[model samples]
Target: MPDDARLLSHPFDDDKLREECGIFGVIGVVDAAQFVALGLHALQHRGQEAGGIVTYAPEVGFASARRFGYVRDSFTKASVIETLPGSLGIGHVRYSTAGSKGQTQIRDVQPLFAEFAMGGCAIAHNGNITNAVALKRELIERGSIFQSSSDTECIIHLMARSIQSNIPERIKDALRRVEGAFSIVAMTRSKLIGVRDPLGVRPLMLGRVGDGFALASETCAFDIIGAEFLREVEPGEMVIITADGVESFFPFERQRPRFCVFEHVYFSRPDSVIGGKSVYETRRRIGVELAREAPVEADLVCPVPDSGTPAAIGYSQESGIPYAMGIIRNQYVGRTFIEPAEHIRNMGVRLKLNVNRALIRGKRIVLVDDSVVRGTTSRKIKEMILDAGAREVHFRIASPPTQWPCFYGVDTPEKDKLLASTMSEEQMRAHLGVDSLRFVSLDGLYRAAGEENGRDDARPQYCDACFSGDYPVSPADMIERGFQLKRSA
Candidate 1:
């Protein structure tokens, strides 16, 4: 594993759910690493800490580049791309959800590679494997030497130990032993492969790029590389692509799909599509549903900026209030802005966001934001709004209150640290010093995501454990470590 060379996350970024990773792969495209880089760039919002790419050409064989920073910073340079020349390639952008958090090692970065008895293979994975600890312990006891602390590395070891003769077959043999969510984009010497876990707790999509096929975490990535969207890799399904065409297989038991509901709320780009619906339209509908469920009279409807803009627009249109950009985001601010000095650290959200004082002064404001986790950022924003002479600040969240910690790859504060876990809506309002705080109900959220009759309590159509505390898959490792499941009613 590469040494911990220090990667800094934005100081204020701690208030939101941290996305796990983004992955992309191509098998038949010329300059395939370039396309993989472009696709990872499009999905950068999912993970920004580090990136890696692996490629294979008959002349060069398996070559890899993993670095601790943005993809644009490293992969864009010809010097770096030149080394990875091939027609088949895969890449990964990572944020630490399953391994070391603030301290990331270069080797911890992905497109993790290994050489098998059959051949060499590289894999990029999203989502957490719930039983990784037990699997790793067993692997170590059985004499499998470990390299990195990542859960994804366990998959490589599992594949190496498989009795299956072929790489794809070994993948099936390996995945069957793991639990929880995973959406993987992997490359064998001649093939590009994609797969989703049994429950479909995360997302993986297949697209067509010229004669070659592309696999990515979202449709937005396909759009970036001029790929035509084909369809989603169904839950429990594996897709193998070569020059000939694409082949699909179901390697796991079928179950009710449990696609992460939060993707519609925050993880995915608004322009992307999931479950055959536009993410932007779904967020807008969330605001519309919120207006009907919790209507408020205010002078202006304003968004917190960026993530909140689409929903604010919907709220304004539904409530007959004009929408305003009350908060301005500093477009140039990068996560690399390190605040080592106390005074600089104290600048906090002000460094990334500022109130449009002229537009905010003396107005009754309704502030729409995506989700509130620890309440630190919300309180800061509220203080900033009030300081700018806003008469009243009402908060409307686009998603249900996140009350439980996510074990399926999202980085979340512990359950006790989550504001919703410890406080009621009224208490949250008081804590943030806002006039009112309202979140879209879980049922309303489902309806916004196109569930006509709302969330089915009998059998949820999506994974909403962060809000509902009804985990679709048992968090086996957490249970062993004394993390209790939600109490039965």
Candidate 2:
């Protein structure tokens, strides 16, 4: 795994410290595969490494094509998109969390195929399965052959052996046995199914375009096709959309909603609305709260860029400070920029973001950023600002400190790798070499989210697992077990 602290060398890391996969499915469309391709293009920000689309026509059977590259690079020509012809399709964009070494190839591209007793099923999943290794072992013991090393493959295996006759029932049964965050879109010969785990740790929304129904990780994808923004797929709910129309089932007992808070703070596009709350507004509120909680007398307030822009605007509005773009990011730098040597990686930050010396010279600046995971990039950013002749630099974090690793889809590192997990606020301030540093309180974050005094059974509870160590699902020795087994073998 890459160093979590060093991940911020790339622009994508600044948007969200954690990485997540995106899944899109459409049913009842003339050019379903082409629509899925366009939808994945809109959601390319969610994941950039690999792209795949699976189409089912029933007469021609199921056809899948995928490539190991950005969606544009993978399928740019009209011919590539037109080749995947079907009325129902599912697409996926992936950023590997585990087994990313050799699996970066096209063979590992998703909408993985499984030939079951019923028929062929293709699945595209977002979020990690905490019990995948154990489940895979158990399934392998039962003589189930595996293909991909992705944790997502386990779900299909479980679905294949389910007692239910129909695909939807089988999927529902399989979901009941899984114990982690998963928002999945599956396509069989005749049906398309969408399911979210009981404790929704990821965002999944349903949309409509004409008579067709679409499901995507975020609403941003829906905007591309002018899909009507229907209500969110409920946590623990399974909705099957086919020629019969949309039908929902809650097969399992409901658990408390644990929607990933990082979605609003970082992962989601600013235009997206998750669980009835606007992501842009939520992040702006976090900035507002941060300013109120930790006010600083500064000459100017500057954002880290992109993700930090909204929060910086809010902070500037709340603090009566002038906001300026102190750091300019180079949009062209891709994932390859971070692959160089140490001195090159150090210089990579400058390539990605350059300080506007004129904006900061002799000014006391308050730097507003979303969150600081591993403090390496934060420390370097502060140094760059100081080097630009800023009189003083005070850092304000919009979200609370991330002290724990996320085992649910996100690529956060172990607890010890997190700067906040070990350092106190003052200690972090000293480490980053800033004049002062303060983080938003957990309560303040909830209050800003307008769920401070939320009822015990709210439908859209926030997932603060990274802030607080209260993980919705415990992955107990899974990480250790996998690493240990790999080492021993």
Candidate 2 Cα errors over 4 Å, as ranges: 4-16, 99-105, 337-343, 452-460, 477-489
Highest-scoring model, lDDT: 1
Tens digits of per-residue lDDT for model 2, 100-135: 434354656798988777788899889988888788
Stretches of model 1 off by over 4 angstroms after superposition: 1-8, 98-102
lDDT of 1 by residue, 1-489 (tens): 111221135565668887789989987889998999999999999998889999999997999999877889989999999999998999999886534445667889998999888899999899999999999999999999998878999999999899999999999999999999999999988988898999999999999999899999999999989999999999999999988899999989999999999999999999999999999999999999888888998999999888998889889999998899999999887765764555675677898899999999999999999999989889999999999999999999999999999989898877888899999999999999999999999999999999989988999999999998999989999999999888999
Question: TM-scores, in order shown?
Answer: 0.97, 0.93
Model 2 steric clash total? 0
lDDT of each: 0.90, 0.82
